[model samples]
Target: MTAQGAFEVKLEPQQDTDAPAGRMVIRKKYRGDLVGVGIGQMISKRTAGGTAAYSAVEEFSGSVAGKQGSFTLIHSGFMSADRQTLDIYVLPGSGTDELVSISGTLEIIQKEGTHSYIFHYQL
Candidate 1:
């Protein structure tokens, strides 16, 4: 089955370094077909030439399409001088409870200053 949802997230700075890179914690509250919260940590940096990169790991505790459980999502993204891209996916064997067999990819979309998620998955 496919589960779909939308979420709003907040990013809070957690650590900083003189190397021009730092880390932050992320919190998310989701709605739609999936309901719950997500928490994660992210590390980000910018290159001397103005490119940015980030990696993060997030655990989502919620119910998807009515199945209650939790899973971890890994993210790797970068914004070059002229382009940007992101990849988010469920970590293998990271599911628990009702989501024990979950596997999927999540697409984050931003338009007109709004954000949403497209979660494509299976159990």
Candidate 2:
């Protein structure tokens, strides 16, 4: 199934300008088919060759498609001069309540200053 929603996120930098790893605290509030809040942290840094990479883990709490439960999301992202790749997935064995055993992935879309999510999953 798929759940659609809009979310607002706040990212706070957790390190100085020259920190080897740029750490950030991520907080999100979502509305629509998926009503919940997510808390996560991200660590990213630029390589000497000018490439960059980051990874994050977020826990989402509340309801998904009317199912009362929670799950964790994992994020992996990479950037280079020619391309960028980002992958977000539901962490296995991290589901609770009705969402137990939930598995799948999530996509984030941004348009005109608005952020939305497309979550495709199976229980």
Candidate 3:
């Protein structure tokens, strides 16, 4: 099963640099024997060479295979200098779906200064 989500991201200035800090809120819906909706937040800061690092926390609310459970995710990832690539690690999490707890990578492209990130999950 594949999950699809739309995210709204906001960037704010932090005292550290000329580049802004970022926050992303995502709402996702997945289709399967058990359907679900998830909301996640990512907090990011700019690093050297126009790159950025982020810590993400996510919460899921729904039932899977008639079993209702929730989980929290903590992950870290870095964005490339050109903002064209993002590498992420899904770290460990308490959840029924162990497959979700895996490493992932993302590719980001900027259009008019707004970034579009595409994710690739690795188990």
Candidate 4:
């Protein structure tokens, strides 16, 4: 089944080091067809070309279609200097409890300060 939803996220930057990359943790509350809360950690690096690259992992807990449990999603993508592209998907074998056997790709859209998602998955 496919799940669609909108969410708002708050990001908090963690302690900084001498490295060129910035690290942060994310908290997300979701509404609409999917209801849940998730926490994630992200590391962002700025390339010499002025583009950004990011990697993150998020664990979501709640219910999907009334099935309750938790799962983890892994993300890896980069933003171009002129455009951005992202890849967010469930990590293999990462689903737990009632969420076992879950597999999916989550498409995120952000515009004008609003963030939404279209999740394609099977459980």
Candidate 5:
């Protein structure tokens, strides 16, 4: 199944933790076909060639297409000089309630300051 929605995100800078050069608390509000609030933490580092990498683990609780459940999302991303790679997926066995066994990937689209998502998954 597939779902499409818009999400609002808030990033709060955290104190210099032992993690990396950058740390933040991530908060998200998802709407449309999927509705939920997600909270997580992110650590990012600057790499060579003006590139960067970041990783985060977020837990989202809500209803997807009318089925209620919660799941975890793991993110891995890297930026190159001319391109980027992002891997955002639902962690295996992380689903709960009606979403148990859910596996999928999420793609984010940002344009003009608004953020949207395409979720492809199997339940």
Candidate 6:
């Protein structure tokens, strides 16, 4: 079986001044009845001139027959001044937990232009 859908997400930066950057807690709720569970990874980099970029990857398992299907997601990109572009990958699962994969990228346009380091995510 195959399933497809789109989602909107909101992010908030919890700790911005920590080394290697702090974790941005994500709270995403989808519309469909299907439920999903997974893990995610985030990475941040800073330059000499106080510029920074960040990326994230998430792997999830969806609800299935008395169980749940699984997926692996990889999102990466850079942010400069305020604008950002993120590349996303979604890999669907097989019976054994791996199979077909779909990928896409999202252009994140920052409305409030500031370097205060408070980021918010909404989906």
Give candidate 2's error at residue 21 in angstroms.
0.8
For residues 1-123, write the lDDT of model 6, one tens digit per residue: 323333335566666675666566454433233355445657678787666777776654564223444555556777677675666644333223322332322233344551111112111
Model 3 per-residue lDDT tens digits across residues 63-92:
544456555545576668455433443344
Count residue pairs with overlapping backbones in model 2.
Answer: 0
Task: Tell me each candidate's TM-score.
Answer: 0.92, 0.91, 0.45, 0.92, 0.94, 0.47
Model 1: pairs clashing at backbone N, Cα or C within 3 Å: none
lDDT of each: 0.90, 0.93, 0.52, 0.89, 0.94, 0.47
- Model 3 residue 122 distance off true place after TM-score fit, in angstroms: 16
> Candidate 2's residue-wise lDDT over 1-123, tens digit each?
899989999999886677678999999999988899999999988989999999999999999988989999999999999999989999999999999989999999989999999999998
Candidate 4 lDDT for residue 117: 91
Query: How would you encode candidate 5's per-residue C-alpha lDDT over 1-123 as one tens digit per residue?
Result: 999999999999999956657988999999998899999999888965689999999999998898899999999999978989999999999999999989999999999999999999999
**Candidate 2 residue pairs that clash:** none
In model 1, the runs with Cα more than 4 Å from the true position are 18-20
Residue 107 lDDT in candidate 5:
97
Indicate whether candidate 2 or candidate 3 has the larger lDDT.
2
Residues 1-123, candidate 4: write the lDDT tens digits: 888889999999998888678999999998876799999999999878788899999998887777888889898988885787889999989888888988999999888999999989899
In candidate 2, stretches whose alpha carbon ends up further than 4 angstroms from where it belongs are 16-19, 48-50
Q: Candidate 6: minimum summed lDDT over ten consecutive residues — where?
A: 114-123
Highest-scoring model, TM-score = 5
